[model samples]
Target: MKALIISDSHGWTHELKTIIDRHRNQVDVIFHCGDSELSENDEALKGVNVVRGNCDFGDDFPEELIESVGGVTFFVAHGHHYNVKMTYVPLSYRAEEHQANVTCFGHSHVATAFMENEVLYINPGSIRLPRQHPQGTYCICEYDEKEISVTFFNTHGENIPELTVAFKRK
Candidate 1:
């Protein structure tokens, strides 16, 4: 299965629509880590999975969520509540509690993807306002029963070669 992960859009509906149009049917799932700031009525996310961020005021979105896909469990959150900018301690603990194979979040506006102890952790950065990096970014995860591969993509929709990572299921 394949998944498109994005976060911290901060209300860039037009860009979000472009991204959805490009990957909607190609991936098995779409994850929005939050700060969408878009109304639920917007059709840009007809079938996307999303969580709320601190900036997504009054949106009725949950602070965290869990989902199972292709035999893998995913823990999704906005990261601020967990103090992501400081460290991953709290988030890692939460992932362990949730027994998640993958943990995804957004808050720092920086893209990161790595695996530790057979678990995948990803931050898709911001599509609207990136910090410390000029390029806006997102991530794609491809997995089956044996292995998984992750790739980060820039705003131009080009993959960042050096940011790719491959993992074997333990």
Candidate 2:
């Protein structure tokens, strides 16, 4: 299955819509890692699985989500609740509790994807307010029996090959 993972849009509904539209037919699921600043009922968020960030003021969005898809279990959160700014150890513990094979989060605005302790952790970065990279970014993940591949893309849908990574599935 293919999944589109984005985070820290902050408030750019148009950008999120454009990104989603670009991959709407290619992905099986879409996740927003929070700080969208959009109402839960907003049309842009219609089919997007989203979590609340420290900046979200509504109660509609959850703190995290646990979903099983294409044989991989995913734990998606905004990361603030798990102290992602400091370390992934806390998030790792939470993923373990949920028995997640993958963890997706945002807060650091640093895009990265890697596997550790049998769990894949992904940070799609901030699409609107990027920090580490010169351009805002997001991630797309493709999962199959042999391996899972992740690729980061800029806000304009340009692929960032330097950040692409793949891992063999166990």
Candidate 1: give its CA RMSD in angstroms.
1.2
The candidate maximizing TM-score is 2
lDDT of 2 by residue, 1-170 (tens): 88999999988888889998898888988999999999988877888999999988869899999988877789999999888999999999999999998899998989999999988899999999898789999999998888889999998899999989999987
Error of 1 at 38 (Å): 1.0
Query: Ten-residue segment with the worst summed lDDT in candidate 2?
Result: 39-48
- Give the alpha carbon lDDT tens digit for every residue of 124-152 in model 1: 88988987678898889998788888888
lDDT scores for all predictions? 0.87, 0.92
- Models 1 onward score TM values of 0.95, 0.97
lDDT of 2: 0.92
- Residue 41 displacement (Å), model 1: 1.8
